[model samples]
Target: MSSIPIRIPTASIYEELASARTTPKTVTSIHEEDGSILDYTERSSDGPSMPPHGLSNQALPMDKLSRAQLIAEQYIKDNKLLKAHEELIRCVALSKIIHGDGHWRLAKAFADLAYSYLTVRGLPVQAKQHAESAKNILLRGVDMSKSVEEKREVLGTLVTIYYTLGMSHLLQNNGRESYVSLQKVQKLIADLEELQEKTSVLGKISDKDIALALGRSCVLQEKLSLAMNFFEQAVKMVISSEGDSSAVLIGIYREMARAEQMKGRHEQAIHYLLQAHSICQAVYKKLSEKAAHTGLLLAKAYAAAGRSEYNENTNKYFTESLSVYQIVLGADDPQTQNTRVEFSKWLIQIGKTQEAYKMLQEAVGSETEYSETVAEMLSIMGSIHLADGKIQKGYQLLKKCLEIQTAVYGSQHSKSKETQNLLTALQKSGASWE
Candidate 1:
């Protein structure tokens, strides 16, 4: 029996896919207001169209598809995410033209495009839409898959679709939906593992990635113990794949620290934070923002531990954090100012009000704008002065704080009302402000 020859679709199909109003819309539509696709394709009106390798209309759709996929991968490797996103959009259109809308191949194309939207463009809503579309197509394709290889391929695509959907839900803060979708991903990965199939669908995602995401969703749902379990699982996976000194462990350690802190295991939290801080100091520049942030977390953990022995450690980390922030982010940067404010608050808590007041004074003096940070510093400075029996200075600072609160929060806001009440009480205390 002679098998029928498969005829490839002509360039006319590519033209229709390119020009038809009914074709899958590019993901750039999600950010059309920002003009992200300045020169995306032949349909782009803003600038000269960038056909794949300057291919003409006569180019075969399959050829264009292969080129688009290759270019997209290259763009991703080069960290040109926007360009990659554009090529992925082209691949989606070309895939539909080559393999009809319901084919598993098309579903795989949509899944790839969805993942690109999520990771490359940071557009979760678009990612969710494309992933759902892929899921619908895959559901039909899975039943039609005949060979074991075809079934495995469909399952791989399903895994990617579900994973993208899960992450998109997580990014949108829908914890329950995120957990459900991620659970499906976990089951699918297990199935693939049982089949002795390498998970090619998990290009950048791994068992550790799924575990970490599950832990985060569990954290959002307030399931502390379960979250810690998943976090520890992630830590173990990372340690097994990459040694303990791997920089990836820093984020996992921080997440574990947060979970411990939430569970009121302060010592455990401090232990995790110390590990993360040490990793940051070794992997990143000591004065880098990453190291400074880790130091800040460690300092906060020490302060929250509420032990006298940890006070020196707390102060040391706080000072280091603030100095690093000042040196790296500049003194006028909001992060630097925030670190200074946090350090001052910690100082006041430890009965170092004079030092706290001086730090706040320097911060306030450098301010060019009346921001919420300035208002907070002023309020704290006023309270410090009042506690020290410097009524005149306290009154002046309180008045300035009140003015800023009124301007920032409006006269009827709770903060403004509170400041107004404080000023009124000061006046009743016989403080003349003529």
Candidate 2:
């Protein structure tokens, strides 16, 4: 729990430095950066006070708290979780010491500490504990404050803490708890809105975010219609701002597509995906990972809906998606290889057997891992070989695919059984394209 202490540079230090400009006759010394403070003597020309008891003293060093926060932020940016945890813990301890346990600043420090544990360290239990502590402190501070602005600040931190708790619960698959926490966030946002103040602490957070969170929670609970309503609200909130906030609009569109797909409305899903793709094109104005991914989603919706144009969009998206995946995730990455296999399946569906065969061959040649990607590629290659009039080669590849499927899915699985039946039929018919 102990951390190395860093020296604080108080706001008074800046004032002192500024005062040095007018008092050039007096000695002005700069402190060395070796963690020491420079002492300054006062030169008040207004003469010595009669009592001197009411004179203000030099300001305390408070910048160390800000410095500690900055250090923790950089540690998080660098993915140094342990260091971030240590620095935030130090900040929290120092804040409690300086501001006492009930101050809103201490509550904020506790919230930051909880975030470090939750996001950086992935320690949900500790994160929840810290969040609870922060919430308690903020509640106490809110009760003690008379001003609405002061109470709002505490309430904002409280909302964020609940949001963190909700996300943590969601990640742990505690759907009911996540929903409850997020519901609290919604309630707090509504309360803040009723204040009719322009400086509402919830300014950065819109109803759209609350709706999206609720929608995702509803999705987890299998309430498709309810989820769709929330997605609709989120979409409505940002639709007018699409030109300025295409990124947000794109995400909402994708979520809407997901809800539509779950409801077996593939055409509607495709509509949302196309809207997302249009935003990606207009906002980015160039080839980007977002555009490529949106293209893939559109292709998927097309395929799912049994559209005749599936192959056209599939081929276009697969080409761009594969290229971007290679550039962003590396050529040999399992994800890139898996994407190639997925693309091959579409190619084979459209009678482009040679192209599919070439793509699978590259995947099989480089990928040594025994994954579903490899097995799928083998199965696709088998079909390609059969199309090319190579029965023996196709049968051999089919057997390999069956073996992998049996190993991965077990012999009793539908996938293994299907592959087994295919091989059996191939043998019985002695099929040959020639």
Candidate 3:
């Protein structure tokens, strides 16, 4: 049997998450390897911070399969996804030779290949094809199995394949299909638990993985509260496993913050955002693009948090995050421009119309293919102009913004309606365009 420890799903897990208070985990500055989240500190960590958890069928010898899987994983970490895909293909061929066709081991190889295609290579079509192949192979294995335990083991492998399929759908923006696939996986897990009578369903599937995937599906479904519960449970699982919290908890924290933000729980959102920032800072490269992305997320969260309670830290976070985005993403990048727009809007909110106007001017001058962002810049600038007593200038700018919005989103779009209403109000205020 493979020595890989797998997490099994159970009803108590969901029950606990549903009933527990949602609290951001306390983060410290030290790398306490005991699985606690650490402060955001740049480190010289070797290899990828998040490596794949080795999983395969128990029937295969662990050493050879593990070796190939590790090599493929390293390729993925190095961003050589094509190489990773090739390596997995080789592993799949080897598995077919050693474990024969229709074996669960071969099914696992196919599943891994599908994951590489879906996530690394961004080939959803190929990913779905391979996921189905894996599922069909695993189903055949389960049908031929004689013992209940054997059937359960094959089902566990299917759960992983189903997850890959869900990811494939998600990658293609088929959220409803993704949710359906995830639900099927959950049902399979439930069946396995029932058969085992609450015994650990820990085969090749982790409850944390399932929970996180389910959380993502719920997010697609707009069930923010349920999503947060699942994300919290996933975080708890990471801590309990003595795993590196930085690797696992960062994404969970970010998603949890998003859910809180959607629910208008700005304080809670900021808490989770801080936790995500802290974790990303702990292990992520200081000047890496990943750090910049995380900073951007924190910036938006800080801005939202400030909307409810304007604090110095909100400004501090925005300043630091904007600096990082500017340096790493460059002045012309859409995200950097977006960050500038956000900062300018914040400045306007705090009665800094002149500064906001200058900022928006700089942002609007930048060339971008994103007309939506351009429209946003123009609107903010118009608002700043209005606040600064330039009624005619604000009127022209608002009318221009409305035109851009209507062109991009059509006249009947909600965004266009908003701009139209704003322009009408400005006109009613005697702001005339000559």
Ranking by lDDT: 1, 2, 3
- Sort by TM-score, top down from the best: 1, 2, 3
Model 2, global lDDT: 0.70
Model 2, 1-434: lDDT tens digits are 32333233234444454454355333323343454433333334464322111222332224545666787777878978666766676577557656766888888887777766666667677677778888888666356357877667766777778877876777676767878988998887776667654246654456777788778888788788988898888888777655545578888889889988999998889898888888887787536666767877776677677667565776676787788767767766666787787777777666677887898887688545566877888888887778777888888888888888888889999988988998888779956534
**Scored by CA lDDT, what does every candidate get?**
0.81, 0.70, 0.69
The alpha-carbon RMSD values of the candidates against the true structure, listed in the order shown, are: 7.7, 11.2, 16.3
lDDT of 2 at 355: 84
Worst 10 residues of 3 by lDDT: 1-10
Q: Once superposed on the true structure, which residue ranges of model 3 sit more than 4 Å away at CA?
A: 1-80, 84-112, 133-142, 146-153, 169-180, 183-206, 242-245, 285-292, 305-309, 365-372, 386-434
Q: Which residue pairs show backbone clashes in model 3?
A: 41-281
- Which numbered prediction scores highest in lDDT against the true structure? 1
TM-score of each: 0.84, 0.65, 0.62
Candidate 1's displacement at residue 360, Å, is 0.8
lDDT of 3: 0.69
RMSD (Cα, Å) of model 1: 7.7
lDDT of 3 by residue, 1-434 (tens): 12221122123432332222221221112222333322211111342221122422122323435666788878878978665665676566556656766688778788877776666666777778888988888666345358776666667667767877887787676767888898888888888877873245453357787788778878877888888888988998998885655468888888888788888898898788777777777778656566666776776776776564654666676677667777887877777777787778777777777887887787677553438888888888887777667788887888888888888899999988987997778668764543
